[model samples]
Target: MRIGMMVDSYKPYISGITNYVEINKQFLEKAGHDVFVFTFGDLDYKDDETNVIRSPGLPLADSGFYLSMRYSRQAKKILQTMDIVHVHHPFLSGRLALRYCRPAGIPIVFTNHSRYDLYAQAYLPMMPEEVTLGMLQAYMPPFCKAMDLVIAPSAGMGRVLRELKVENEIEIIPNGVDLASFQNASPTPREKYGYKSDDILIVYAGRIALEKNIPFLINAFTGIAGAVPNAKLLIIGGGVQQYEEEIRDYVAGKDGAKRIRMTGRIPYDELPAHLSMCDIFATASVTEVHPLSVIEAMGAGLPVMGIESVGVGDTVQDGVTGYLATNDAPSFTAKLTRLCLDSELRKRMGRAAREASKVYSIERATQRMLEQYERLLREPGRRKDKLYFRLREILQRSLR
Candidate 1:
């Protein structure tokens, strides 16, 4: 089988979507299937893997995303040869697949990995919430219905789509984690990062973007640091330089400034070692669709305390593998303090977390995705190429 993964952006961007596409490509190839990445970006950017087809697009500053309406001539030609095309980003890549592959009888699977409504609120705060939600309601249903299959990374996200009036049948498939690299990772020595061996390190590993709510994490940590003097927060990701600088400034203004450390973007392969050095993993972000970082941290044998919503709520076993608390500083700080102060509880939960994380291993996830692909191929009326296009035209005319 030849699989094409379409994304708005790719490597050097360091996002969960990028990681997902990369891992899937590797695992699928190992299973004797050819995988290709179809994306828009700098044509000069070096890809670490083979069969990555890039089309030129207008660069959107340093945000690592490109704005392109259609694929290059070569990309369009190669993408048509694929048996299946999995789209990660809905708007850009989704439309491109609808235009090209749908006519060729290639099944397109779209995974809803983002909470676009929340994202719109975060990025375009000036936009009214009503308008944002209304736009989503108008857009998502038709686009999702057009695809051969729609995938939601977690049950929580599936519910979000249903609420948005996306009446299509949705499949719940959790994102996969490469557990081997994290399971027995060697931690970076405490002395190297200027931390004492006794320090109870709490780590948050992801993009330092607005949607992540880094300031909220800092606020929660402030309440915990006073209670547990040895507690530390290690932010192990990077983002727009301005946002990183803003987070740094906020941390500097806090009382226990020395307790906070920010390591701007580590290599994807070296992530485990950083995770291994932490005692607890914590995140306050409510905009996750199956957080791969939390799974990776759990695979590294670290207990987690995340906001009780969506992906984090689904992944964590609450008081068993970790604690899931309300999205408040006092509630989250209590859990953070509890995990940091009690070594035995951390150990027990860490063990459970490691065990629970096994279910999301890359191999298992790849197999599940492959099963879906095979099912789609064998099912009668699987290739609704003409039907979908005809319906789209009708829907568009009716809407207008």
Candidate 2:
């Protein structure tokens, strides 16, 4: 089947969503399906068999939302030739797909990877909580209801959709990891980082943003170091400029401040080695749908500790694969301390985590997504063309 996968961002700008698309595209193409990516920004990638379309009118920062007009034109032309148009996010690309593909009678499948309400709350902190929640309540239901099929990466996210009164059929499909690439890689020697072989390395890999709750991780590590002297925290990835200073100051205030290492943004290829070197991985973010960092840590056989936030429950099994803490500094500190103090527990949990991660392999995820696409294509009332324009006009009127 010919498929057009639309996303707001793609490679070179790494995130969970971009990684999901790239991994799934590889598996889909390998399975003999013709796949194309319609996204923003210039991708430094080449695939002779797969097509990648770069849409226009993308803004400097919020390029994803800014592409509605350009994507409308680009999507109409490209989606016309495809059997299914799969949208990664339910914003501009999704709107474009619905507007163009629906009229042409092509089925559109949407994946809700991020919790829009939580995301809006983080990015637009100046907005009142009531206003953000109100906007989400108003916006989510109809957008979900309009899609041919809606897929949520975690059951928690699926529940959120149901609560929003989204009448459309919703499926839970967790994001996939490249198990082969992440598993059991030899650690890059720690001599470069001035780590002794006996040092317990804790890694936090993801965008260092306010929403990620990095400060909590730093605080938790401070508590951990009070007990375990050789413990070190590796802060990976990058974000706003101020976060660096925030992290620096936090670490400096601690007695073992020099143990904290910030690698800025490591290249993707080196991630496995970095993961391999770590004894434990942790994240405090409550906003993730299916955090790729946690999955990658699992793939590397590292014991993970994080908040028992909605979708995250599916990945981290308390006292089994990894510890799941409540959303508090004490809870996170206790979990981190447990993992750091118990080597045997870490090893056991790491083994379980590796086994659990296999379930989210790229092949399985791609097959599930393909099944959803095929099912949607065969359903009745699947309009091919002109429905999007009509729907857009209706939605615009309602919003105003």
**Model 2 per-residue lDDT at 18:** 76
Each candidate: how many clashes?
A: 0, 9
Please provide, for model 2 over 269-369, each residue's C-alpha lDDT reduced to its tens digit, 9 standing for 90 to 100.
79999999989998889998888889999999999998988767777999999999999989889888989999999999999999999989887887788
Could you tell me which residue pairs clash in candidate 2?
99-388, 103-384, 103-385, 103-386, 104-384, 104-385, 105-383, 105-384, 105-385
Most accurate candidate by TM-score: 1
Q: All candidates' lDDT scores?
A: 0.91, 0.81
Candidate 1 on 269-319: residue-level lDDT in tens? 889998999899999999998999999999999999999988899899989
Clashing pairs in 1: none
TM-score of candidate 2 against the unseen true structure = 0.90
Task: Tell me the TM-score of each prediction against the true structure.
Answer: 0.94, 0.90
Residue 1: error of model 1 in Å? 0.3
